[model samples]
Target: MTQPPPPPNQPPGPPPGGFGAPQDPPPGGFGAPTPPPQQPPAQPPYGYPQQPQQPQYGYPQQEQPQQYGGYPAQPQQEQPPQYGYPNQPQQPVQPPYGYPTQPQYPQVPHQPVPGAPGGGRKLSAQLQIVIAAVVAVALLIGGGLWYANSGGGDEEPNAKGSSGAATGGGEDGGAGGLGGGGKEKVPADTKAKLAFQLPVPTVPDVTDVSGSWITDKAYVKTGVNSVVGYDLDKGSALWTLPLTGQVCGASRHMTADFKVPILFEATKRVAPRYFQPCTEVGLLDLTTGKLVWQTSITGGTAGDKKVSFSEVTLHGQTVAAGGLDGGAAFDLANGNPRWKPQANAGDCEDLGYGGGEGGLVAVRKCGSYDDPTVTVQNLDPLTGRPVSQYKMPPGVDFAAVVSTKPLVVAADVNDAADDGSGVSDFFSIDEKTGKLKAKITADSKRYAPRCRSTRVEGCTQVLVGNGRLYLPTEEHDGSTGEYGDETNEIVAFDLANGRMVPEKTDAGDRYTLIPLRMDGGNLIAYKWPPYDKGGQVVSIDGGTMKSTLLMENPSDKTTRTAETSFSSIGAEFRYGGGRLFIADTLISKTKASTSLYDKKYLAVAFSTAG
Candidate 1:
């Protein structure tokens, strides 16, 4: 797991400038701000050999210019103009897959100091102007560089779960199932039309509004302090279940009957106690838009203190939650305590759990806080007892359960993976024997799966099914000759031996593909839109790895902008019954400078039936 870097030391006082107010400049003269220290060159992803630099396709190469002082200053010949912005320099450099290219520095002529051996000579006026212009260009390019932050479980008697499925209209209650079971409805026409959009609710500050689900009649989502079920086609409120406090966490898995688990505060936020602990757990019935039951437990050191949870998940009849304080479980149908926090001999506590139709798995931590030993266990859903346990390799302080049925775990062993994706290698274990089967090394530079370091079931864009693991390759240069046009593909690895599968699915030119979930034996995926196009949803045959488009959204400016606003990396996506839904997990207060006529949405839906 990657830990945030420690904060830089600060003077013992308020900021040099009071909050939101300007302050005096430093004592030293100020011209251009000091250049940041040069960072060490990035290394190749862990366990992979570094390849020699080579000229990449789609980019033109130019002769290298000699340094100023090393060779006598000679007349420079004019070079052919490069592509892209006017006067932009083009160097033939290849960035690591999925990573932004390092900024190229322009060589400048060295100036002689006043008392130096070369003696001082004033630069020509034209030369000074040229230098200033070069500096300005560099500054502009540096300022434009921005970075993106990229940030699941089991099982039981094979609970008939659906993968990315939602109920369609009609008396049969629509097709497709939720989480892992059932067949997805295939529409006659693949082209999709706009159905409706739900506007974002106004909030006083940045608020966590995570969690969403799709039912036979409604698209359910969490709001500021309530859960609202919206008409699937009309986008109007079907029903709203108000809560006393904000939702803190929700289970990704929905039961066969459409019930899900969630965590929330006991009371609404107010005054100095503006933030409340996420101590209450509840079961929500999406079909009825009601809280089936709500309850909390007393744990921690004193035994009679409320336990706060960071996440909750459901499996079979049990709904389990875990946090720093420990873990607790309850009957999913009714709010009855199944088990509470209990530390083992080594003071190990259940950090969290990953639950789905595949089964229930837990991540346990033991030993001293500074030197923790993490273990992954397959547990009996009803008994809260380990069926089989796999102790993580030494030096692995954290682990995430990606799948429980086949038993796959991901961890950044020895913290060698520098990327914040929280994974370096995957361990395939024998669920019955708790023995290691294969350790698959996923090079962070080449693979695109992301998992939150702190959340035991937070892995995304990665899937396990049919005895294989599917992952997206890091984005790379596309076939098109146009610069900045990138694409990626999905590849599979055999879970038995950890060998790469020959068959793969490509995302086509300018589009990046990511695995959404498994629909029976098929893999559902989303194709991220290019700048001028709308997004797409496709189903890849599990055996052939061939994709069939299910829905392609509108490419008009208005629709394209709205569709692209929800990033493929950060937003939640669901597609089934010829419909696709995209939603946000967080919403922030509108800025004062924003126009009133501009629209913001919590979710947008599209369908082929429209």
Candidate 2:
């Protein structure tokens, strides 16, 4: 038989609350009663006297209901308006047309008797009422089952032609709890025990996207040419220092030993060629939130534009800073001039990186961007003079500094002309002799260049720490001379010998690992959700390669929606004073009311304390 169509949409009625089973076969149709089966009288054992003959049995066992197909079909007969009861066995074929019909028995009310309404019980008016009540209960139960199996009242129609319950995202449309709203599931070990998170300060001109954390405070650059120190644990501003110069810039650095200096630079805010003749540098006493000492030194030549100070390293007792014009080293405690390294004539610019054993690295470009002749020099922190110098591979350009102390790690520009082939590498140089100690392996494939990553506000793909280098890259095929798939693999290489170390083979790929920093001998990183992949904080033991996933990315439904685009704000992740800070910036397709800043930023902090 054809099945019936489904019912139309309608507000559901009350829930079903009854129980029932299929009704028995209809009345009368039970079947013709069978005559009783004849049984021969038992003959006594041969010696016993024969028993007197017994009368024939009156009723034959009702012939087993005639089987139709596999399942038993209900007997055909009139159905009762309420509970349908099956027919009872008929009396023996009316013993030859009324041989004085066997005395008929009277039916009892509300009692079980054979072949009576409701199985021998006569249907008195009260009985009918009881049957109706039972039927009503059955209907109620069936209705309740229907309501439950259908979509409940909580769901809304999904835009994609389906439906889902509202996830109850938070203010930013991100789920509030750790694993709520379909966010990446947090591994048991690395789930965050948050210490605190401060409201991101609204700054007009944010000079630095990353924050520098000291004992209990973090220093950040504001838009209005100022640097502010905030209590990292309490989310309160401690102090603010304004830079008074034309093209001013500020940076904060904390050394391994906890020495911190707040560095500032600018040109005269005044007239002709408002040039930055000097950079004002100071060391701050974190506990008192006071500047221990401050001074300005004239090193690089002043010009029409502002002096750009790029790398700021706090090594031992020295503060090394460099800009377009030149670089300088100063006493960290008293701010006394150490040595000023000047750019030679025809040199494009001078840059500095932290050198091993408390030294410094200066990359001087002697050739223009087209010709590109670069020299790497290891400088003494105290003297600011070259301890050792070497030229980079012929046509290769200089990339960013990966490490400064104990061993200097730097990447060569990945352009075709630089390597003359498809390979790109990061080199570990011996600081004493400025010689290549090893050509570190970066990326996954042994022969391919590293993955060229777009600078995200807070994302860094390559990390140098302890004695190893961590690089995130896509697998490449050497024979084809082409990159393969998109599964980004993070490879760790020994800085000592530049050999790739084996990762735990049995640990199956969990999340995309991108190296972020080295903290307390642990390699800190952010993992992409294995399920819905993106930024998640994780820490890997540098030695074992074991990974632990920390805070998951806030549930961001928009990332999967067509209404918004995925982008990173390029805010650098920061780890210091036993805490990890993550900054995230995303743009929305929906418009918003006027605000001081065009966009908002999320700053989350995680702690290692028990």
Global local distance difference test of model 1: 0.66
Encode model 1's per-residue lDDT on 180-270: one tens digit a residue. Answer: 3327656888788989988888776677887999888889999978999988888899999898799999999999889999998888877
Query: Cα deviation in Å at residue 330, candidate 2?
Result: 1.0
Cα lDDT tens digits, model 2, 1-610, are 0000111122222212211111223333234222224422221221111111221110101112222112221211111112221222222223211011121111222546588765866567676667755644443222110001111112221212111111111112111221112222235454334555444444323224333454544634332344456667654677775555422332334655445665555433333432344466666555555567776554345444334454456666777666555566678767876655433334444554453334566665555657765555555555544455444544356644456554444453345324222235566655565444445423222222232121101114566654556655432222333433223345445444343433321112443445666655556665544334334566665555556656544334422111112122244466544455555332222344355333343454555434
lDDT, candidate 2, residue 177? Answer: 22
What TM-score fits each model?
0.70, 0.53
- Candidate with top lDDT is 1
lDDT of each: 0.66, 0.41
